[model samples]
Target: MKTSDFHYDLPQELIAQAPLPERSASRLLHVPPGDACFADLHVRDLPSLLRAGDLLVFNDTKVIPARLFGAKATGGRVEILIERLLPGNEARAQLGVSKPPQPGSRIALDAGGEAEVLARFDDGFWQLRFQVEGPLEAWLQHAGQLPLPPYIERRPDAADAERYQTVFARETGAVAAPTAGLHFDEPLLAALRERGVQTGHVTLHVGAGTFQPVRVDDVHNHRMHSEWINVGAELVSQVRRTRAAGGRVIAVGTTVVRALESALVDGELRPFAGDTSIFIFPGYRIRSIDALMTNFHLPESTLLMLVSAFAGKQRMFAAYEHAVRERYRFFSYGDAMLLWPGEGESGSGDLR
Candidate 1:
């Protein structure tokens, strides 16, 4: 299919400029697959709608304050975003500067010192080891700012320190927040736990590429961005046990789905920790995950492609249209949706 297949019109005013007062207070719109009818609901209705024996899988990857600005030795400005920390104190990063930074050049950060680039990774990526004079993690907390998406068109403030993260966040790695997980609070999670819903966690450090536009005319030719994911033995066991007991595995976001799917090697899920560039689009058969709870996505985004794969292309667009007509808020700080596999896309054993 062409990239234009998933295109939808959204009003500029609907793009959320600020987060809602409370995370759970955001609105939800539930749309059934292959149908046009959509019901307006609240995010708190999640636990009530899910069955008791279902396993709710959430991505526990934490977003680090990875956006850093500094100066090159020549006094030119440079913006850096830490993509991943490699072994031996080495780090892979993306650099945005007036001119490309050269190897062995120094980037002086505001925290009293600098780092020198050892090599160039790719087009705009650099591999550098820090001489921070202290631990890099501790240095970042005091120096870096929140890595807000470019579409936001504003500066990060105190509220973003808390509002931009999910309550379940634990392991620090992600550059971008798994926005789907942001809606669940302690109370909501507690309620779900009390209702006999089992929960499992995985880590998939979301990358900035998640928000990148698909510039290709043909969607199939587009290459996905690489992101790190870890699925431990414990998570693999939980998913298998859930399936054994005829319980559904509900993935919290597209990131979790990729982690779970990437771990599925040789027709069975296994523990996996590495970079995955898996891309899911319409007509792709899902090997795992029965249901998906996620937020409304950007137009022509890969996220829309993943959701469209689970729900049929026609059904998914119908749901998106309903959301637009109902004045539903869109993107990061916007509303959410609960979806089951479409008629032809049965997630569990109930194929139509």
Candidate 2:
């Protein structure tokens, strides 16, 4: 399919600029199996929507304050977005500056630190060595700002430091949050537990590339972004046990879906820890998840393509139309969708 196949008409005003006061108060559009019409509900209703024994896999990769402002030794202003942190206070990052800094050039940070450009990759990323007093993570906490999505017009504030992160966030690595997990709170998690739903965790350190647009006309020509993922033995065992007991494995976000699917070995999930560049579009049979709970994606994005592959392109477009007509919010800080595989799609069957 063409990249344009995933495009939807989302109004500018409908793009959510801020998070709701209550995490679980956001809207949820339920797209069930077959040709059933979409159901508009609240995120708080997830416990009731899911059955007992179902495993909801969540991505626990925590967001880091990765955006920083600095000036080159030449005094030209530059902006940095850390893509991946590395050993020895080094990192791979994307730089925003009038002129790209060459290797050996030093950038003096606004927060009283420095970074020396060590190398540049053909993909537009730069490797840098930090000149901080202590650990890079600690220096980043004091020097960097929360990197909110570009669609959000306002600057990141104190509230965003908390609202943008999920309550279950523990493994600190991601530059962006696994947004579907953002709607979950302690009370809601408690409710799901009381409903007898089981939970498991996967770690996929979300990359800054998640926000990059699909520039190719032919969807198949686009290369997917790579992210670090870890699917542990415990989670793999949990999935097998759930399937044996006839319970569905529901993914909380696209990152979790990617993590789980990438770990599949000969149609069975295995423990894996590595970087994955797997691209999911129509024609790719998803064997990892029975349902997906994810936030609304940008028009014509790779994320939209993944959902189209799962729920059918036509159905996703129709649902997006309904969301727009009903004044539902859109994007990272926006509402969410609870989706089951469409008829004839891989993993579609009696979910009960």
Candidate 3:
């Protein structure tokens, strides 16, 4: 399919610049497969909408402070977005500057430290060695700022530091927050538990490549960036039990979908702990995730393609049209949508 197929018109005003006052206060759009009808709801309605046997899988990957502003030795400005943190106080990051720094040149960090540009990779990221006190994580905790999505117009503030993170966040590796999980709060989790809706967690360290755009017209030519994912045995057992008990596996975000689907071995879901560059588009045979609950995505984005794959291309397009018409918020801090798998335009409302 062509990348242009996923394009849609979104008003700039509809793009949420900041999060709502409450985590569960954002709007929710429920689109059942194959119909023109959809329900307008809120994030707090999730527990009531789901059945007792339904399992809601959440991505607990914590968003780290990856954005660091610094100045070059030549007095030029530089911005570093840590894509991956390695051992030895080293990192691979997307270095932003008018003129790229030379190898061995140090950039003065705003975090009271400096990093040397060791080398540049073919992927356009620079290998950097930091001269900081204590561990890199500790240093970042005291100095780095939260990395907001590119769609956000303003700079991150105190609210973003807490709002960008989920209540269940534990693992600290992701550069971007899984926007879908941002809707959940401790009270909502308690409500889900009270409703007998089971919950599980997976970790997928989202990289800065999540913001990368598709440049090719033919989507088949596009290659997805690999991100680290971890699926423990507990989650595997939960999935098996959910299936055996006739429950639905509702993936909270696309990240969980990738992690669970990538863990499939010999047609069975197994524990996985590694990196995955799995790309899901139209015509993909999805073996995991009975439903998806996620925020609205950008026009012609890989995320939109994923939802189109999970639902149907036409179905998703129709939903986007409806969302725009209804003045629904768009992007990272935007409203959410719940979708069930169905045939594109041709089939009835039976969820696969």
Candidate 4:
């Protein structure tokens, strides 16, 4: 499919700038399989839409304060967004400056300490070694700012430090949050458990590349950036058990979908811990998830393609049109969708 096939015009005002005061207060667009019409609903109604024995797999990757401001030894200003933390206080990051810094250049961090540019990659990431006194995570907690998505168009405030992360977030490494999971809170989770709905977790450290636009016209030509993932044996067994008991394995976010799908080897869901660059488009068969709960994605983005692959392209387009007409919020701090696999896909139909 062409990358342009996923394009949808979203009104600028509809892009959510701030999170709702309540996490589960966001809207939920329910897109069922086949010819069924879409249903407008609220995120709080999720428990009623799901079955007792069904499993909801969430991405527990925690968003970190990955954005930092610093200056080059030459006194040039620089902004850094850490893409991935490396061993020995080193990291791969994207740099924003008037000019790219060359190797061996030292940057004096605004929060204190320094970082030496060690190398650059063809894909726009730079390798830097930090000179912090303690653990890099600790230093970032004290000095770094929350890396909000570019679309937000606002500086990080005190509220964002808590609102941007999910209630289940624990494993820390992500530069961006698994936004679909952001709709879940303690009360809603308790409600789901009371309904006998099982829960599991997969960690996929979401990277800044998640926001990268699809540059290729041919969707197949696009390459996804690698993100670290860990799909543990317990979750794999939970999925199997859910299947055996005639229940769906619903993914809470695209990140969880990617992690679970990447762990599928030889037609079996296996435990996996590694970096994955898997690109899922319309033609790609998804064997991992029965349903998906995700936020609205940018036009022509890899995330849109992934959803188009799960749900039908035409259905997704129609759904987007409806969402726009209804003024549903979009992006990271936006409303969400609960989508079952399209007709002829790997999952059951009309889960409700």
What's the lDDT of the predicted structure labeled candidate 2?
A: 0.91
Off by over 4 Å in 4: 345-352
Instruction: Choose 1 or 2, whichever is better by lDDT.
Output: 2
- TM-scores of all predicted structures: 0.93, 0.97, 0.96, 0.97
Report the candidate with higher TM-score, 2 versus 3: 2
Runs off by more than 4 Å, candidate 3: 344-352
Query: How far is 338's C-alpha from truth in model 2 (Å)?
Result: 0.5
Residue 99 deviation, candidate 2, in Å?
Answer: 0.8
Per-candidate Cα lDDT values, in order, are 0.84, 0.91, 0.89, 0.91
Worst 10 residues of 3 by lDDT: 343-352
Tens digits of per-residue lDDT for model 1, 1-352 = 8989888989988888778988888888776655657788888888877888899999999888888878998999988888877766567888888888888889998666787888985435688787775677777778778898877879999999998899989989888999889899988888998988999999999987776789899877888878988999998999899989988899988889888888887659999998898888876767778889888898899899889888778888888888888888888888898887877753321111
Q: Which residue pairs show collisions in model 2?
A: none
Error of model 1, residue 141, in angstroms: 1.3
Candidate 4 clash pair list: none
For model 1, name the residue pairs that clash. none
